[model samples]
Target: MSLENHAEFKLSITKALGDQLAAALKKLAPAPLAMENIRALRPLPGVYQLYKNGHLVYVGKADRSLPQRIEKHFRKISGRRNISLDQMAFTCLYVDEDFGAVAPERLLINEHRGQGQVPWNYNGFGNNDPGKRRDTTEVDEGHFDHDHPIDLEYRLTKLPSQCMEAGEALPLSQLLQETKTHLPYVFRYQASKEFDDIAVEFPDAETTADEALKTIAARLPDKWQITALPGYLIMYPKIEDYPSARRYYRSTGVVDVW
Candidate 1:
């Protein structure tokens, strides 16, 4: 019995594997992508689909933990405007760990791309901050942040240790540096020693980060201001027009000389 005919079995199974994974993921019932639900699930290796308003918007693969990767998406959405956690959901499937090398995500993405749009993957949804060098460039017209920019009105809580008490003076530099750590979104600022001499306070109770910026500006000398870019915040020593900014903050009160 000689079975040398290999055409029946393709050596490259990447596409077939991707199709199988995609089909499996599509069959799983979507669960709320909220933190509470994600935290409850044990980490699993697999491919997943993210839906916005029940429409499939993204596909991803987690070689190690499904909960951690999806949790990141939840956090990313929580800090942006024009979107809500209630409108988001996800479904996933466990793939064998050995398949991680074939790039399961690419497989899933390719399969889904043939079916419909995977908007987030192309719009830089999972990308980190583009950094200060790219700040001046306009965000791609249809990018995720362009469509649902960061919410300056997003409240601040669980602040880092460097945060100061309401009405308590703290160096502006330290305050800005520490505040960004807890944020689910990006906050960038120009570094300056001058910020060390400036002291600012927080609201009596937890409040919007935008309000904090307003309060911080109250003590900053002339020319120091905070600009609310579409996707993040930037504090600089001088007020210059930022074409990409949604708005700007300035000294709304006279700095106390005492």
Candidate 2:
């Protein structure tokens, strides 16, 4: 096996220490899967996701504590706990973590479920979709399973004037753009950290702490959406909802939405 595989193989031996693992594991955990271009902004608000293959397994919000949130997922991955996704690749995506507070994280969870992007839970959600009506047609777009990437230029803030006033059936792109601009500071903080890596730098402890809060404040608008989606990185919004969106996600036994 290659050196990386060998290391994980060696570490698996310590799995026997289940009872004492949590605490010890925390200190011994490896650094998170760092992102590319993670030095664009000051520490601020954002959302993050952990993906296996192109599918999302977990989503989280960072309210100025991007590193800490990222670390949480890394520690979970490193622990001896059972994890069995089809692909093991891991990468992170960030938006405004405020998305967490505004909407239910489960919304993102449901989005992925609707897309058939995430693997079915062990309870057999995947196999149980008998009618096949509940299944999402696998699309050709890459990472759509997790991030649902769209044209970045599609501005969400400048909603059609009449539609904005009436709150009519506005397009998803308009909604997103509005949300992004309404919370520019938040998105800026988010994009900055992922693209810039603010957490790894900054010498003053107080300054670092302040920047973290600024990030959180900047991202409040998007945090509402993250609250809806749960653990998905949110490349963008989905065009259609899954037929079994509610059933699959609601039945998955998720706890309170964060």
Candidate 3:
């Protein structure tokens, strides 16, 4: 014969704190993630939550200033398509620097892990750039960039320093390198002697990436093509099938080598 008593009390320290933080954040009203709204925020360390259309989607922390960190996100989202800045909102809690060693953002993420909120925390939304090596890699169909690729439309505002004004001719290679540096997203290309020697005149200020690529491609020698991959772009001197390519801009001289 056997007799037993079963009793249990289980709690994780981080999860407990996370639960309380989540509860408190939800109770506070959310404001637009716009600069005007965040401009009023004090430059102090804190944790924050981002919402899309009133639905929680991301959690973050700033060991320095909450305003600066949130502003970075604001500029990034403003350049993308399929999402309106009007749909983004945020809520924040100013925490003592002493409390940050606990990593409040991680704790908050732990609490919401299985709940389907804060999806941006794990998705590529938090990534600034996946880097050049990942350029050839195929993006998962569910990745954030796959759903909302860079808005090449009316997005090429930063011109190369060599050409201060529109309609100025810039060496094709300089244009490629300068654009890669200026764009909020990645722009990768191959190097060649022709790109260095040839100069292409760009269009007006409102010109889009498509227009720019077409201008560049039109000036290139035979067989050159510029392809837009899901997360970035790659330019080469031949037609090639990339599983991740969404669009391709072919050189005007592709039919016959110059």
Candidate 4:
């Protein structure tokens, strides 16, 4: 079959399944948020749906004990205190084993989202959804094939004077050791805005520029200060050259052979 036909068939099956599930869920009476109702919840793994004024608001799964998880939602221990239980009600389906809750939760979330029902639930309920995939084999090979060098850069504010004392540039070993001990999250350093500054980079897909800057700044010593330059690029030598690379740079000094 053509790819388009295959896709349509799969979508149809998914829609049918979702419709059946939604119908079954609607038949399950919602329980109140009172102490007696909460205590009556089973301790088995399950999928729970929260409703506000008869509208589905959120769907969640508990792999261990359903009652404990539901209690946390009510007591605000799960960081959901903002959710008022005064008009909220819930319904749950107990699963025999923990893994059984996974599909039901995902399906319920997807179904509710399709119907525009759960505005409070962010990005559906599945944990294993593999988001966008990219093929980077050619891109990676091209970098090495073209000998295209890349340097990561970080901007800074309060650089320590002791690290750049005259004729006493810090050794790469010490810098690396200190980094490993205090700033292990820093994976690479490429270039700096100033000779005294160093750069830090993180996976663009996993972290935002602000998040990376905050994390690196928090991990650094109080004596040092770093800043984030969202769109700036600087060049430096490869990390492997660190063994012989100057620990600090001085524009006036005779360049060291590395």
Candidate 5:
């Protein structure tokens, strides 16, 4: 059968079962799963299911209030075109503590799976087993080390007084151009006891650290003092060093320094 036809068939079965199903579900005191009524739900930990046209699509447990959790889901679907709040319904059972909701949620997911319901509980719903840890004793731990020697160049600039006073330092996300702004180099912003610091990054292969530093230096305003550090050194300056400053080569594989 076509996917659309299968969905229609399921919806038909749901409609046919509507009166009986509503009668049965009403015994559990299920709610209409609408925004206006969400605040009326009990603010306790619980397990909830999302039904699309009476067909179960998702099961979730809430460690907090069921109302808050359900409201979040409502907001998420509100912005989506494929899903609609009008076709969705929810039923929840309150539990005492956060942890108590887990087992019941797992049991429901397992029961649905065994019955071929297949609610979207993909990661083995509520499976808390941490899984075995791998033995890394024989593995050269050095291979995983990010500090492997690579030539690193850096540019250090003094923070403007307004930025220092307001503590409005740039975040790594902004420096990496994750925001709308783009910069020539990746840098980490730091606020120290002595002065505010920004450590520029030099990735391997593309541009030599020295060349990158010169380019950065040329672009920076004259009010800022620029300095170069010799090799890769992670900064952990003492509190007494307040403004202690040094630049170090950040290795190629280094993912995050913060």
Candidate 6:
């Protein structure tokens, strides 16, 4: 699809999510705030801001449901006397609803806060400038044929080899796509393997190995399943569902049932 069309398509989905989020907020509140009709909550992906009595305080993002996320915050702070939810009279503003969820949350928070303040949440929002792009990695020649469709097993098996050898970071797909020509086969191979290693190094980055598996699962082809094996990640392709993939990968070699 053309870039314009792709953007338009994403916008449509984002707008739908915003509507759903609005509805979810009404049901979740201790006392429902005035629900304004957000006719076009712009299809862009970004962070959302929640205001209490005109002051910006709570911020979050939802890859799937915005309202559901807002509701979660409301439920958490309903009765608490915390510094974060100091004021009342709630309002939500959709800011930076483009690129995706994770970074937008970071950008909005940083836009309001400078270096001295603690970042609101454990997750970091990427750098604020949307213009700054991320890296993308490609499948190596030996890993998969160019004509073949990219799938989970193909990507996971190929990850350690595809990543930056010494660094702990995994480049986003956009960055990999942009820098494909400059990267060598050995670099790509290392990247592919690095996916799991990065997860290990930053185990705290994800709440748990299952969560990391889910993130990795999202990048894989629809058919592949990710299961935790003893001391490694086991991937199986073309399966409808594997209860095993949901199993937790612990520090121990055994895959524990959740």
- Winner by lDDT: 3
Full-model lDDT, candidate 6: 0.36
lDDT of each residue in 10-109, candidate 2, tens digit only: 5532333222222332233232354322333246555444566544555445666665655443422332113432233333334455444543234444
lDDT of 6 by residue, 1-258 (tens): 645544333345544554555454434333223222222334433345555555444456766555555544443333222223345334344444455643555554454465323233422221121120111122233211122211212112223323444444453333323222221111121134333333322113213334434544555444445443211234444342333232432222334343
TM-score of each: 0.83, 0.27, 0.77, 0.40, 0.38, 0.27
Q: CA lDDT, every prediction?
A: 0.78, 0.32, 0.79, 0.46, 0.43, 0.36
Query: Which stretches of candidate 1 lie above 4 Å from their native place?
Result: 1-11, 160-166, 252-258
Model 1 residue 86 CA deviation in Å: 0.4
Candidate 5 runs further than 4 Å off:
1-26, 98-102, 123-258
Candidate 5 C-alpha error for residue 40, in Å: 0.7
Residue 96 accuracy (lDDT) in model 1: 80
User: Tens-digit lDDT track for model 3 on 39-132?
Assistant: 9999999999999999889999999999999987887777677888899999999988998988999989887877888988877887876765
- TM-score, model 3 to reference: 0.77
- In candidate 4, what are the lDDT values of residues 1-258, reduced to their tens digit? 645544333356655755666777788999876567878977888778887778887788788788877775563311121234577788887765734634767777788887788765663222121221211112232221112211222222223422453454443333433332322122334423342343333223333323333434433333333311111111123211222222222222222322
Candidate 5 Cα lDDT to native: 0.43
Worst 10 residues of 2 by lDDT: 243-252
Q: Give the better candidate number (2 or 3) by lDDT.
A: 3
| Clash pairs, model 3 backbone | none
In model 6, the runs with Cα more than 4 Å from the true position are 1-46, 82-86, 89-98, 115-258
In the range 156-222, model 1's lDDT, one tens digit per residue, is 7776633555567777777777667666787777777887998676664567777677777676778
Candidate with top TM-score is 1
lDDT of 2 at 184: 15
After superposition, candidate 2 runs with Cα above 4 Å error: 1-42, 81-100, 119-258
